[model samples]
Target: MVSAWETWVRRLVTRRPGVPAPAVAEATDPAGTRLVGAPEPVSRLLVVRPDTVALLTAAGTDPQLRRPGDLLVPPLLSPGAPPVTARAVSTAAVDLDVTVTDLLTFDGHAVDRAVLGVLVQLDDRDWYAELLELAAGHADDLEEYLLAAVHRELTTAVRGAVRMNRLADLQRLTLAAVLQDRWLPARLGAGTLRCLRTRVQRVRWPGEDEPTVPVRPPPAPAAPEPPPQPTGPDQSVPAGST
Candidate 1:
C-alpha cells in the first residue's frame, strides 16, 4: 500500500497535460528607482531632473494613454524608478512632484465644496417654497391681516378728509362705520331726499350765467394828445420865462 506522504507528494506533482505552468513570482521594489536618491521630507513641488528623461520618454510613448486627462493609477515603475514617465503629456509635461495623495486631497476638497454649495442652495429654495405653502395654507390669517390694513387706511383717510374740510357731508360717511351697521342706508327716506337735493344743487344748465361781482371800470382813455404843440417852436410865452 502507498504511504500517506507518498500519496500526497504524487498528487502535488501530477498535472494535466494541456494546463500551463504556474507563473513565477518576482521581487518588486515599491519606491521608484529614479526617486531612490530623491531627498527625504519630499516637497509638494519637485522639479523634474535631467536623468529621468528615459523614464518620461517611455511614459509619453505608453499605448494605454490614448486620451487627454487620463491618469496612470499606480505608476508603471519599480521602487527607485523615476516617475517622469507618468507626468508626460502630448502638449506639455507636468514638472512637479505631485504624489497620488496630493492629487486626491486637492480633488476631494474641490468636489466637497462644490457639492456643499449646491446642497445649500437647494436647501434654501426648499425652505422658501415651504414658507410660501405655509402662508397659503393659513389664508384666513392673511385675509384678516389684509382686511385690518384696509380698514385702518380707510379710517385714516376719512379722518384726514374731514379735518381738511374736503369732503361733502354725505361723502364723509366712514366705510368702517357703515360696515359695522351692515351697510344700511342712513336715511332710507329723509337722507335719500337730502342726497337728492344736494345732487340737484350741484347741477347747472349749459351756458348758465354765474353770479357776477362788481369790477371797477377801466380808467377812461387819456385825453387825446393836444394837437401836436405847434410843431416847430414853442410859441407859449412860458418858454421865454423858463
Candidate 2:
C-alpha cells in the first residue's frame, strides 16, 4: 500500500512518465497536464490514497468513482478485478489547494493573459459521472486528467468574465467580482470539482495588480507557548528570597 502511494505521488510530481520536470507549485504540474482519458486497465488490487478518489468501470455496468482510501478488489474469491471502460481519474483533497498557471482571457476587444490559481476540492458524491465525461482525453494517470479538466474550467470562467468586461473594468477589480457573482450561484465545479478560492498570480499588462476574491482567510497562526515555569519547585531557590 505504501509503495502504491509512493509511486503515484512521484508521478504526480512530474508532468508525465518520461518528460522533463516543469516548475511545479502546490500540485506537481497541474498546468502541465497533457492527458485525461487514457487507458487505465486495473488488473491488480489498488489501494486509494487520501488525496484522490478512484474511478472504475466494469463490463455491463455504469462507471463509478470510489472515495479515497478505498480498496479496489473483488469480493472474496472473485475471478479478478473488473474491466474499466473509460479513462480513469482521481480526486484532489477536500480543502481548496489546487492551482493553475498562465491563462488567456479576452477583454471585449483585446486578448490578455492572466496567470490564475484556484483552490478547490473534490465533491465526493456528485462529481463522479459528470467530471469523468468532461475529462475525456489522453492521459496515463487520473491526477493528470483531473488537473487538465480543472484547467479548462478556470480558463473558461476567466475568459467569460474578461470578454464581457473592459480593461478598465478589470483594473477596478471587476473580474474577481464577476467570477463570484456568476459561478457561485451555479456552483463553479469544472467537471464537478468545486471552486473554493481564486488568486490572480499575475497579469500580462503592466500596472495591473492582482485582486482578491471574497473568500475565507487562512487560519490565524497558533499563538506561541510561553517559557515553561521552573519545574520541581525551589531547587534553584527564588532570587534573593528564601
Candidate 3:
C-alpha cells in the first residue's frame, strides 16, 4: 500500500495549477537507510510508520534532518525525511504552511520519533498527545533528546530576538535622521539665531540665561543737509576768524 505520505504527494501535484511534479531521488546514508528525496520544484514526503507525517524543504540547500545522537550513529542520515511535525522555528517572512504533500516528500519514512516530537512542539499545534507518545517510546534517550530539543528552541528564540532588535534599531535611526534633516538649525550669529519661520517659536538656544540685547537699526541718514543754510543773507559768517 502506498504510504499516507505518498498519497498526499500525489494530491499536491494535482492541486498545484501549473507547477510540475518534482523528481524523486533516493538518498542513502552510510548505514544504508533509504530516504526519498523531493528535490527542488518538488516537495519531499516522509512516512513514519503508524501515525507520523512530515514535509521536508525542497528549496535551495536541503536541510539536514537528524537528532543529536545521530552524530554517534555511523553514516548519519543525510536529507533524512520530513519531520512528522515542524514549527516555524525562525522565519524572515510570515507564517508558512507546509502542505501535506510537501512534508511527505521531503523525507520518506525514516525519521526518528524523538525528532518528530520536537517538530510538533515547535509547530505549536494539536499534536501534544502524539508528542508525548513519541517521547514515551524513547525513554532511554528522553533526557538527551529533550535537551537537544530545548537547544533548538533557544537557538531559534535568540535569532528572533536579534532580528527584532535590529529592526527596532533601524526604525530609531530612520526617525533620528529624518528629524535631524527637517529640524536642524537654519542659521546662527553672534547672540542671535534664526530658524525656519515655522519653528521660530520653538527654537531654543544655548545662552538663554544671558539677556538678549535689543538689536537697534542704524540711525536713519541725517535728514539730507538743508541746502546750505542761506547764511549769506543773514549773519555774514566770516570765512576768516573775525
Candidate 4:
C-alpha cells in the first residue's frame, strides 16, 4: 500500500525535475529541491501535514485536479509569472470548487474530516450533512473532524461579521477561532489585539481617541422673535388715552 504512494511520488519527481515537490519523499532525488521549503505536491492519497494541505489549498482550483484519476501537480506558471505566496488564503479570493466525486477519491485517506471540511467550506462549497456524518462515523481521527467543524464555523462567522460590518461580532468570532488553535493558546488573547488593529486600520481610523467629527457645543436655540408692535392704525393707543 505504501509502495503505491512512493511509486507515484517518484513518478511525479521524474515528470517535473525542478517543479516543487509537494511531499517529503521517502527517497530524495539529488536533482530536486527539498519538499519542506517548496510548494506542496498534490496526491491521490491524503496528506497528513496541515501546512502541506494548506499550501495545496492556496493554489486555488485546477480543472485537472478535480478529475478523479488525475495526478496532482504544481500549476505551471506563465512565463515571468510569480507563484502564490500567501500562507493562509481566504476562499473569497479564489474561484475554486471541488466535486463530491473528486473528494471521494481520497481512498484510504478519505477519513480525514479536516481536509474534507476544508473542501466544503472554502469557496462556499458544501457537502451533504449525511456525507460528513458518514465520514465522522468512520474517521480514524475524531479530533481532526471536530477541529475542522470548529474552523468552518469560525470562517462562516468571520465572513458574516465582515459583510455586516459588525466589528464586535467579528472580534468575538476571531477570538473564538484563535482559541481553537491548540498550538498557540496565547493567540486567543493576542487575536483580539490583531482584530482591533485590523478593524481600526480597515476603517482608516488614525488615532484611538479620534472623534468621528470635531466636537463643539451645538448652536444655542435662537431667541424667540419679539412680537411685532402694532403698525399704523393697528397700533394700540396709550392705556389712558382714547
Highest lDDT: give the candidate number. 2
- Over 82-190, each residue of candidate 4 has an lDDT whose tens digit, in order, gives 2322111111111111111111111211211111111112221242233234222422322223333333343343333234434343344552343233322221111
Stretches of model 2 off by over 4 angstroms after superposition: 1-42, 74-77, 80-90, 94-111, 126-149, 181-190, 206-242
Q: Candidate 3 residues 89-199, lDDT tens each?
A: 110111111111111111132111111111111222343333334333433333234333333332243233223334334234542242234433332111011222211
TM-scores, one per candidate:
0.14, 0.48, 0.17, 0.17
**Top model number, TM-score:** 2
**Lowest-scoring 10 consecutive residues by lDDT in candidate 3?**
87-96
**Model 2 CA RMSD to the hidden true structure, in angstroms:** 14.9
Q: Deviation in angstroms for 124 in model 4?
A: 30
Positional deviation of 146 in candidate 3, in angstroms?
1.2
Better of 3 and 4 by lDDT: 4
List candidate 1 segments past 4 Å from native. 1-140, 166-242
- What is the lDDT, from 0 to 100, of the residue 218 in candidate 3? 89
Which prediction has more favorable lDDT, 2 or 4?
Answer: 2
Give the per-residue lDDT of model 1 (tens digit) for 1-242: 65574354323222113212111111222322211121111112233323221012132332221123222332343455344322211111111111011101111221010000000010113322332343233322322222232223323432332233322322344322322333222211111111110011121212335558989999999998878655777667865585
lDDT of 2 by residue, 1-242 (tens): 33565354333223323321121111233333322223444544655544455555566555566655566664333655455533324344222222333433354445446555455555545556665564343223455445545555666676667666777767777556666777532334444666666666556554445666889889999999998887775677668996
lDDT of 2 at 233: 50
On lDDT, the stronger of 1 and 4 is 4
